[model samples]
Target chain A: MKYLPLIWAGIWRKRSRAILMLLQIASAFVLFGVLQGLDTGVSQTIAKQHGDRLYVSSSVAMGDPLPIGLLARIQSVPGIEYVTPRADFDGSYQKLDQFVPVVAGDVDSFFKVYEELKTSPAAIRALRNDRSGAIVGILTMRKYGWRIGDHIVLTSGLPTSNGSHDWGFDIVGTYDTPDQPTSATALITNFTYLNESRLTGRDHADMFVTKIDSAADADRIGLAIDNAFANSSNETHTQSEAELAAAQLQQLGDLDFIVHGIIGAVFFAVLFATGALMMQSLRERVPELAVLKTVGFTDRRVMALILAESVTFCLVAAGIGLALSTLLLPLARQQIGFSRVPDIVFAEGAACAVVLAFVSGWIPASRGSRLQVVDALAGR
Target chain B: MSFLDQTFALTATALRSMSGRRGAALVTVIGVTTVVGVLISLLALSNGARALGGSEASPDEAVVLGSGAASSQQSVLTRDEALAVRNAPGIKRAPDGTLYLSATTMVSVDAIRSNGKRGSVALVGFTPAIRLFAPGVKLIAGRMYRPGVHELIVSDPLRKMYRGLELGDHITLRGTEWTVVGIAAGNGTVNDSILRADADTVMSAFGRNTYQQVIVELTSPAAFDTFKSWALSNPALPVQVKTEAADFDDTFGQLHRLLDFVAYFIGGVMASGAICGALNSLYASVDARRRELATLRAIGFGGGPIIASVLIEGMLLALPGAFLGAAAAWLLFNGHVLSTEGLIFTLTVTPGLLVVSVSWALAMGLIGASLPALRAARVPVAVALRAT
Candidate 1:
């Protein structure tokens, strides 16, 4: 620790070069912080599952609707507590650019199943009393600047009974889930209104969410529900909400592969660039290193000093980069209209920075340690 | 000395000096290569995806959608509307004298991927005359599906992705089984993500009473405006008309823009780091050569030659790096197929992308060399010589 001043002096010997190296390392880490945050956010979203809730959909494909009649059969299962069916309205406000997914279900049962969504008592009462009333997530409200009691007309992709594709509903409530802020993008309306209004596919839902009494009963209930519809025209596939999320992620594409590929390329480049710069800096300082050895500094101490110099450069720069990314991510998320992007994971980034420092500093540090005083002094 | 003579002398000196510091020069080259390579590869990915979406529709074809519907998935037209569109003036007739129109029904169905996960795949039902409308499509294996039969022709790429899609294999849709009759290739277009079947069979199976959209080939590209005006003004059929290219742009334009933004943003961040690394290396090189350069200046060599030599050396180092990085991207990612939201695109490392990458590397060399070269030019000959 006493050699801190010496290490600092060595780094500052060429102030411009040191600053340049700092900027290089900092920029790389900024990229790292932002990319890693996005990668982890996606994986975590897919991994997060409500233990007691099960998602039941058709075995055929995601777009295929399940018969609403299955709601009663699923509720009949022993472990099932409450069940709610949601049909995807796939509506957009005004234009395609303003797409806001609206799920239709019985308002009361929907709220009972998704207890995480926090809302006012009056809002809940409004949704139940008015057939055309809708509830939106806080993020969605913020996105479009919507207010309570405002009527928002959405154009449905699917045709309705009146041969018109426009559907209007009063925004009666705005809900938020403190634990899962990403859920703030959801907009829910009464399925009874949808069923009565849509011309075709009236008695069906895109999926059903069931609440189970016990977490341990998830497997058995899932199996029983699937078995009951095994031979039916529309076969059902039931899985825990986590498994469903994972499956949906798979449908979205192989995000893990793409993310890893880009990150790998980036780290490889940074490692080589930093290592080269360190090698050049140390090679130039060999004579000085030898002089320190002649003045009673041990070989190990010289190595330690060089290593400390490189590590300081990397870590300090990385710290700045991470801070910058953390500050920028929320604004980026809001602009992009993606609510699920988690904040930067600091521990993972710090660990990566440490590893980067060690790797980039290793060869140069060893070279500095192995220098012979007489040979280095003679400029050989 | 003349300009050509001066440049040649500087180039010779730069080459000789760089050989002595090969390791440092190599590092700078590698850094520049990494930046350019990553930028090109990511741009290629976006280009490939955009090409897949944009090339599906031709300028000669017009699509009729319900007003305000952005995509066929959102558009619906009854049989009467389809008939009216088919008979609209300026629509070309097929070789068999029938109107060159294909009324398609688009539906999304659950299918099992080869990896054992289920995902949505677009199931499109088109008449046999679709072969005339999309002439670029050809059977890669087996024969085409027979009209009115519960038969399907799967795209070659889609077959590779999904299970039970091989020729003669059975896939159940809406409780009825359809046999895969052929594997078709759409020359890297969006059709490669769809399963083609007869319109009546698909509609009956999925319980749809209307066609999603009608695609018609105009008599000439100029005929589109006339055909569109007639369709919109016709009292019987109220529909919207757009060129196939315009429809595709509306559908996938946002996704393309997002991909491009991400690629450029990340690339810009990495490039800044690489540029700094290049600058540091060049500055150090010039500092190491200060005494030698000052000696040349003492003998009447001009500052212009010294500056030009450093700049030329920077460009030389970056050139090889650009090539190496571009070669690596091509070797690793070219033709690499990836799927997103059921759409498949193959990363294409084209000659055009390689040119773009090399240009970026050249720009890096210019900027990286400028400050160091200026510093070298300003070095006082007496002080530089006396220091060592």
Candidate 2:
């Protein structure tokens, strides 16, 4: 710790070169921080699975709706706690670019099945009483700046019975899940109103969400539910909520592969640049290091000083880079209209910075430590 | 020394000095290589995706979609509306003397991928005239599906991605079993992502009473505007007409834009880091060569030759880095196939992409060399000599 001043002086000796290297390291970590944040956001969205819940949909295709009558049959299955049916309506708000996913279902049953949605009893009653009442997720509410009792209209891409594609709903409440920020982007409405008002495709539910009494019964119940509809017109496929979310996220893109590819490229270049600079700086200071060794500084202390200098360069640059990304993440999320991006993963990033510091500093520091005082003094 | 003699001497001196500082030169080369390699690979991905979207339609074809429809899947046209479009002028006739028009229906069906993930696949239903419209399409295995039968033809790429898509395999759609009779391959078009069946049969199976869109072969490319105006003039029918190429642009424009933005944004960010690294290495080299450069100046060498030598050295180092990076990208990503949302594309490492990558590296090298070269030129001879 007492060698801090010595290491600090070593770094600042070449101000321009040190500053440029600092900028290089900072930029690399900035990319790392932002990409890691996005990667975590996507992974977390798929990873937020309630173990006891399962999603049941048509085996034919995602767009195929199961009969509404199947709700009672699914409810009768043993080990089922609650079941709800949801119908998806893909639409945009006022413009083509503002695509908002809307899901309609029985409000009471939906609340029962998805207990993670935190809503008051008054909001639930309003949704049940008003046929056109809808509940908007917190993110959507904040994004559109909507308040209670606001009537929002969506233009359905699909035609409706009234010969127009306009669907209006009253926003009666806001919903949020404690851990899953992605869920807060969905808009939920009353299925009865959608089924009655829509010009076509009535008496059908897009999928069924069933909460089982025990996690152990998930596989058995999934198979049993599929068996009940086997040989029937509407055969079903049931998957645990985790599996369903994972599959859906996978369809978006192989984000993990792309993120890791970019991160690998950035770090590989950073390591080479930083390591080369460290070696060059150490080579220039060999005579100084020899003088220190001759003046009662041990070889290990010389090595420690060099290592500390390099690690200080890396960690300080990483700190600034991570701080910059943290400040910019919210703006990025706002521009992208995705609320799921969390703050930078500090633990993973800090650990990475530390490892990079060691790797970049190791060879140069060892060489400094192995320097012979007589030879280095004689300018060999 | 004469100008030629000075130029040769400076060039020889720069080469000798670079050889002495091989470590720093190597670092600069590797840094540039990383930036160019990453940039080229990402741009290749964007290019591949754009090609898939753009190659689906030709200029000689036109399509009539329901009013205000953004995509075929969202468009709905009743039989009467489609019949009205069929009667529109400027439509070419096939050898059978029938108008070469195909009413198509697009639907998304749930399917299990080979990796056991459940995802949606696009099922496109088109009239038999589709073979005429897309002449480049070919049946690679088995025969085409017969109309009115519960038969389907899967694209080769789709078959590779999904299960139960092999020849003779049965896929259940809307509770009806359909046999996969053939594997079709399109010429890098969006058709490669779809399953094909008879339009009428698909409508009845899915209980859809409307066609999504009508595609017509125009008599000539110039006839597209005439056909479009004719289709839109029928006030009784609510329809919009566009060239087939325009429809593809509408459908996939946003996706292409996003991919391009991502490619450029990431490439720019990475290139900045590489440039900074290059600048640092070059600055250090100039500092190390202060005395030598000052001595050269005192011996009557012009500043132009000194600056030219540094710039030339920078380009010489950067060009090979660019080549190495481009070669690496080609080795790693050429013909690499990836799928997203059921659309599959292969990364293409074209000569055009290689040129773009090399240009990016050269730009970095030039910018990195400028400031250091200026500082080296401006170093007063007496001050540089008197120091150290």
TM-scores for candidates 1 onward, in order:
0.95, 0.93
Every model's DockQ, to 2 decimals? 0.60, 0.53
Where does model 2 exceed 4 Å of error? A116-123, A137-153, A170-187, A214-216, A334-344, B1-9, B229-236
Model 2 chain B lDDT-worst window of ten: B66-75
Which CAPRI level is candidate 2? medium
Q: List the residue pairs that clash in candidate 2.
A: A61-B110, A161-A199
lDDT by residue for model 2 over A1-380, one digit each (tens)? Answer: 77788889999988988888888888888788788888887677566578789888888776577889999899899999888889886667877557778888788789888889988898999999999998888988988888999999887655566556678889999899776555577788998988888756778888999889988889999999999999888888898987877777778767788889988988998999988889988889999999999998898988888888888888899888777777656656643334433644777777788888889999999999999999999999
What TM-score number comes out for model 1?
0.95
Model 2, range B1-388, lDDT digits (tens) per residue? 7777787788788888788788888888998898888888888887777777654567888878875455666787777778888778888998789888899987788788888877788888888777777564589999888889989989887888888899999987767889999999755567778888999989888877778889998899999888877776777776778887777787777677778787887788788888888888888888889999999999888898888777767777788889998999999998777778878777888899888988988998888888888888888999999999
lDDT of 2 at B83: 84
**Residues forming the 10-long window of minimal summed lDDT in candidate 2 chain A:** A334-343
Chain B alone, model 1: TM-score?
0.95
**Candidate 1 lDDT, B1-388, residue by residue in tens:** 8656776787787688887777778777878877877777787788777877654566789889865465766787877778877668898887669888889998888788888877788899986668786564688899888887899899988898889899999987667889999989755667778898889888888777788899889989999999999998986565779998888787677667877888888878888887888898889788888887788788877888888878887888889878998898898888777777877777778888878888888888888899999998888999999995
- Per candidate, chain B TM-score? 0.95, 0.95
Candidate 1, residue A230: CA error in Å?
0.8
Model 2, position B195, has a per-residue lDDT of 89
